[model samples]
Target chain A: MAEHSVTAAALTARHQTAGSAASVRRLPGFGWSVGLIVPIMVLLLWQLAAGGAWIEADLLPSPATIAQTFWAMVQDGSLANDILVTVYRLALGFVLGTAAGTVAGLLTGALPLARRLLDPTLQALRSVPSLAWVPLFILWFGIYDTSKVILIAVGVFFPVYLNLMAAIAGVDRKLIEVGRVHDYGKLRLMLRIQLPAAMPLYLTGIRGGLGLGWMFIASAEMMGANNGLGFILTNGEEIGRPDQIIVAILAFAVLGKSTDWLLARTAERLTDWQDKLHPETGA
Target chain B: MTRRLDISDLTKAFGAAPPVLGPLSLTLDGEGITAIIGRSGSGKSTFLRCLSGLETPTRGTAMLGGKPIRPAEVGFVFQEPRLMPWLSVRRNIAFGLSHLPKPERARAVEAAMALVGLSAAADYLPKQLSGGMAQRVALARALAPRPDLLLLDEPLSALDPLTRERMQDHILHVAQHIRVTILLITHDMDEALALANRVIVLRGPPGRIVLDVTIPEHDPAYAFPRDRTSAAFQAMRRRLIDALEPAPVALAR
Candidate 1:
């Protein structure tokens, strides 16, 4: 508990220092919060349209109606359950795909023979979109969660694979020469030199793959899943409840932004030198 | 402990071509720096690479301490500072010292950082350093291993004038402190004179050593042709320059 308080105090101090620093530079609270302006404007416009009878009220629900529907869903516990299911699937698919992609990328990148044999096939597979595999996946795994997870996994796999290959290949050849001079074995060379050198690129690939994986999660659910935000939207469509559909869409956007924001924050914390790219951190 | 490098009748050829180095024989006395001065494409870099075991000779051999040169036995500084971007200055210097234990490794890193005057910037990333600072880090990286032989491939050739002078002083200072045998390849005649006690000039096709001269200066200072018009320095510089010129067709054996 003492250690926790110490950490909390340190965090509070850091936050205050950063706040003062931002004000000194005449900077806003958070640079990326500017992106929220678009959604806020859209919500205002949406409220105006739904209330002003610019279109049929049933066809286009107001922001207030959507918020009320969302609150109702949350109170009943169905939205929480759906979100949990969707997040679980996304996490599982990300882990599986990232693991498989990293291993394959490292192996194929380091060996000429493996690269020659695997690259062409992986390249061909990557060109096929994730949605195109839905029918085949449904046939293989039925309308179960397994099919949705696999779809998301495949969707997440390609970005990671491509980025990892690029990272591996893009490692400075001179550093490898240094490793050779230092009598480092092949395994040592890969682990000690190549892998750490390629980490930034690998992290980028993970973030992108995670984002794409979440996108596929909703699409997969929409096609034929019994649970998730996509299922809620599909059910609402079938039952003619436009407010529930809007709430579902709003929830999807919130989940996507939340995960993305969390990943980026984690990246910033881990790779402190990369904080400069965010602008708000002032490097 | 003395380690002598003998390159005996070392000849190398590639793909049905005549040899780049042929039946070349030289024994380097293993106490101090020996500079090999040659024009570009005169195969000096290749010879150094072969000597360092980055390449294998098609014929003959290079033996270190009368033993074959194994990888990592000799530390090599390339023409460029090829540091990993992800690693900081201290990490780059300590890169090859991973074979040491934890305490020894930290000591070695500290020693290297002090030697390069980079202890203050130890936490700074490589991209944050200037070109000269990066090159010094590379030099410190090579020096940290405390190898028996330091093989340099024209390390100072790429630096600007002011940085080059500072680096030369740095190299000389480090060489004096460490007492490692250095084999430096340079086309700069003055640098060869300033840093090396013994200079060997490479000329002729299927290259062979044409001139070998020892600079008479002991405990040399960092000042350059400040006295450029001095007859002795001018005379010596002229001799080295003339030796670098192409051989006459009129002269026949």
Candidate 2:
């Protein structure tokens, strides 16, 4: 053992990354610019058709009419309140679902016994449509924010849970061997290697869960809700306001895209060092 | 520094499968490079795994300097770099040096990087590095802790021929400068002759050391090189190839 304390200058070879191009190629601002073309074209065609009376404004309001209704709602501050209510509920549910799912995921992924006992039950529950719980939840927790939030949370939880479980369980064996070789304790191994390894997939799960949260809105806001984008959608149906309906739908679309964009950007920041062929755009 | 590794009848079997490795024994004397050359299924990797405590041996005791071999005292370099994608080269090298203070750990990382000629790329992530550079980072990471023994499990098997040759020279250089003991497992006969002084040929149904020869001339880092380079290389190659030849029958099952 005395002789093993030798100098560590075991090598003297210079190497650089200069030879390999970044496998992930990015052309600044170009992807979004091109992506906007098709949607813009669709909007233009819709407006032309509506103006020429090629379609009835009763069923499919002109883009112009939709924009006017949108502007009026904005001025009245009602749109703002609806938007805020929807976003607040979605965010609250997303956080709650993410926290619970992450804990459950870590348990099942790390422990065989936990996985055997819990996974089958969770998977079966996931198969039950979140909206299917509407009647039961209203009876148990009532139509207050409690029922609505849990309904949204239930929608969000499954994807997040599954992704986290798969991420932790599927970390590369070769990579795990590196941790073992270091004689790392289990906690250190999980924190230093396993957590970081699980991040990319976990982020994907959160993004999917957020999308599911929006899907849950139609069901969650169907009960005793006075104000929200969902309320506007239902209210439009009762009053025969196609323009209002279109406004609500367009708002949901915009909100979903923007939120997903924010999440994708965060994912990019967290996984920049990943050695993978990145998606061509910030999708 | 170097460590003398003593093995007495080490055997490993996964579940009920036939034993992949030994019920064999040998001693690796301290302070030198030993190369274990074998065929793919001959269990060269299993032997190293047992010593590094990655796999538990079904039978045997392996000791380092009259004590049980500790996992912390083993520096392992696998066939692939197996680096953490999230870590920069410097942080990866600093990984095993966690017991040290931050400043000391940083210094140790710098030293290991300097040793591996990777100082310039310390800030680079694994993805930014070329294959050879990644392997060097792996080597630096292992050496940063200044372990009692270095285990190379086909460490150069993934590199191109030119890069592999350069790494051979790097190993020779390391053996010359450091007092550390190295156990290099490879199927490459030329590689075995290029750096190691002690060459052990492993053969199987149950892999065990079949030939253990101390070719003192092969450590060209210490001796005259040109004359011995070809003649001695050829001689050792023949000797290893002969040991690897198919035999008719075993003494008993």
Candidate 3:
């Protein structure tokens, strides 16, 4: 009986440890597993295709060659500087675009007169591609960080604006009626009910907007910029370093995805119960 | 002083159709449960909407509490719970009382939950609830404000038979305990007879009242039929069925 009790206690302890561990295993916990698999798969596929005579070696270098080139570039410190520059541009543009777009979208969506007056003009502006604005931004702000940042901001603006407008427009009419029934004043209604209700859509827009901002910054920098990943790629072309160019492209893609993942985690924490089954990301 | 409701020649139309309710007059005395019964598309719900200020009368006047009735003062339970997807059951109950102080609001929420037997599921979200539970939460929400008049538009038309009977009993218990007046709209004649002191029937597009029967018994238990096997209960049921049947056939009889 005593042995049985001891074994039972041991089993209980193991079960408790397993349960706690299970609870601790959330979405981000799986990120490392994903991270480990993707690069390994890419490397294995690339090495097989290139080294096994599937593709021309000159066009698609072996994975070993690419790794050697990446190590050399890292040791030289140029790649690190380029990454820093690109990140800085993304941060500035995203902040400016999101703040301006959200405010403008809310105002336009809420007021009929404002929507009628501004919607046409904004619609026309949104059609102008992010690349199309490059020349104008260069003329307006010069071939510097300012011009690249402006281009990125313009790229981020349309998606966030459209989403915010939709979110504001979609605030439930029944809930607004409830607010009126409670005799809640205008400020209270907007702040407490309308804004919180619109949060899921707004955060989703912010995520897409940030991704677009990062994408535009790299492209804008490629067109004309003193420093950034785009500059590194341009220099690569000048020096015939195709490997560096490919690495920069890979780094940009990875960066965009990581930033979006971080934003999604933040959204999950903030709006835990708001949109329990949001159509997008299903978080 | 308790106020009376006077609806005079109330007419309402939608789109290109003729008026749903027209030239109909109703004067409701101080406080009691009045059930409006009719077949589907008989404009019974529309009449309830007009009374609740969800729809305005095109060419008539509806005065309540000796003044023009405002939507805010009349609490309405929609066909569905229509609870905010994000709010908890308790929050939905207190939604209409947001302006109240935190403590008083909490107490009111607890009281309303107790009334609807949803005190244990107060923290559950609307989607987490069963259909009957969600409707119960909706009832608790409507009742929290202690409105002078509560308007329910087929609030229990979705529940199962067993649940519906229980809810009918619950409604009766609440009407007996509270001073609030209720205007219930339903197509179920049995439900109308079970809970209402006075029953009004509406018929057709330009909906008009066809029958108005005041039950003899005031007691909640067996309010419709003191004993289902009794002659009085059977007679009342037959009369109500005849009243609901085609007017031409009833006239021939």
Candidate 4:
């Protein structure tokens, strides 16, 4: 009987743990072998190709040359300054765009009249690609930080707004009924129930917006900017320095990945309940 | 304070379809468990929803303590637990008590959780709970506010048989302890017999009460899990089943 009871307890424990395992598992670590193997192989192959002069050195600088150029830029403090400028633009634009998009999304999602009035025009504006707005933004706001910020904001806005609105609208009606049964006032209902229910999708929207924010920052900075990584890339092309161009591209890739990783970590914390429900996905 | 409920001609219709519920009238002393039994699509849930103010009746009135029924006056437990996935069991119980002072709300939540035997699981999220445990949390949520009337819409229909029986006892214990008027909706006659002091049957496209019977409090045979083989228990069960059955066809005249 004792053995039977222990088995039952173990089974029950397993059942309980099944739903929480994904949430409790540590985020994938930087496993040196798994993470570095492919990149190392690529580097080795590139070294071989560069040493053999298989590809022209000017057109495609060897990894060693790019690394040396990066080191020179870092020593001169140019890389750090460029990164700071790019990061500042990205941060400012992302914040402004996300805030406006979230507010607009909530309004259109919650109020039928707001949706009817604003949604169509916003939908139409969304179709115009982020780069398409570059000229117009520069024309209107000039080539200062304002045009760059506005361009990034415009790029970030549509994804956040569209995804957030859809998420809010898609909140389960049954859960809303639970709030109604409890006599929640309109604002309380939205805050206590609808907002939490919409969080998982809302976070997805923000992440998508952040990705677009980075993409637009490149376009924004490329068109006309004295500082920032994009400016460095353009300058590298003009100066015929493939090493500098590669460095800029690598900078963008690294920045995009790290920011996305941060957002995913924040989302995991915010939507822990969702993670528990779908342990396999850990979304 | 305990309050009486008088529902009269409370009809509900969706769009152009025929009415789902009443033109039905019933009255209750508002202090004991009353189980309402019906077939699927019998509008049992609709009646409860109307009384809980989740749905507005197309016609008629439901009065509680001589006043029209309001949301605050009734607590409804849906068939599904409907606990907020993001909230812990304790917090879900305290959800409806948001208007209370923090200490008072916590006290109420603690008491409700104790009532449902869920104190150990207080901090567990809804997803962490089993189906039966989640349903108990739903009960705790409904009970926390201490509404004048509690509306249960087949609250245990989703549980496994053993869990269902356990929950039936829990419901009985809660009803006796809380002394709140309960209007429970269920299709299970045994569940109705085991938990309800009063049992009602609703039937039809325009749902109406077909039978109403009060179980004797003085009779041991009428107690929960009452000897199913006992003459008194069997007789009552037969009568309920008969009322639920369609009338026998007569010879063409």
Those runs of model 3 whose alpha carbons end farther than 4 Å from true positions after fitting are A1-39, A48-59, A72-77, A171-194, A269-283, B15-17, B218-221, B224-231, B248-253
Model 1 residue A57 CA deviation (Å) reads 1.6
Candidate 4's residue-wise lDDT over A99-176, tens digit each?
A: 999999999989989999999999898888778888989899999899999888888888889888988888889899
lDDT of 1 by residue, A119-223 (tens): 999899988877898999999998888888888888778778878888888888888888877778899899888887777677778888998998898889999
Pairs in steric clash, model 2: A3-B1, A3-B2, A4-B1, A4-B2, A5-B1, A6-B1, A11-B115, B1-B179
Write down the C-alpha DockQ for each prediction: 0.21, 0.39, 0.15, 0.47
Q: What is the interface RMSD of each candidate, in Å?
A: 10.5, 8.0, 12.8, 5.3
Q: Please give, as one word, the docking class of candidate 4.
A: acceptable
Ranking by TM-score: 4, 2, 1, 3
For model 2, what is the error of residue A220's alpha carbon versus the real structure, in angstroms, after optimal superposition? Answer: 0.9
Displacement of the residue B199 alpha carbon in candidate 3, Å: 0.8
Error of 1 at B100 (Å): 1.4
Q: What is model 2's DockQ versus the real complex?
A: 0.39
- Model 4 Cα shift for residue A197 (angstroms): 0.9
Candidate 2 C-alpha lDDT tens digits along B54-162:
9999999999998999988899999999999999999999888888999899888988887777887778788767687789889999999888899999999999998
Among the numbered candidates, top DockQ falls to 4
Model 4 off-target regions past 4 Å?
Answer: A1-16, A19-33, A275-283, B248-253
Q: Could you estimate the TM-score for every candidate?
A: 0.88, 0.92, 0.85, 0.94
Model 2: CA > 4 A from native? A1-30, A280-283, B217-229, B246-253
Q: Tens-digit lDDT track for model 1 on B1-253?
A: 5488888988777768888875678888656678998887667887888877777888998888888987767888999988877788888888898889989988988888777666666777775666777788898888888888888899988999988887887788777777688988999988887777788998745767888887665423324332445666667788888888955657854
Candidates' chain B TM-scores in the order shown: 0.90, 0.93, 0.91, 0.96
- As a whole number from 0 to 100, the lDDT of residue B224 in candidate 2 is 29
Which segments of model 1 are wrong by more than 4 Å? A1-30, A268-283, B14-18, B204-206, B217-229, B247-253
Instruction: State the weakest 10-residue window (summed lDDT) of model 4 chain B.
Output: B244-253
User: lDDT (0-100) at residue B43 of candidate 3?
Assistant: 83
Q: Candidate 2 — number of clashing residue pairs?
A: 8
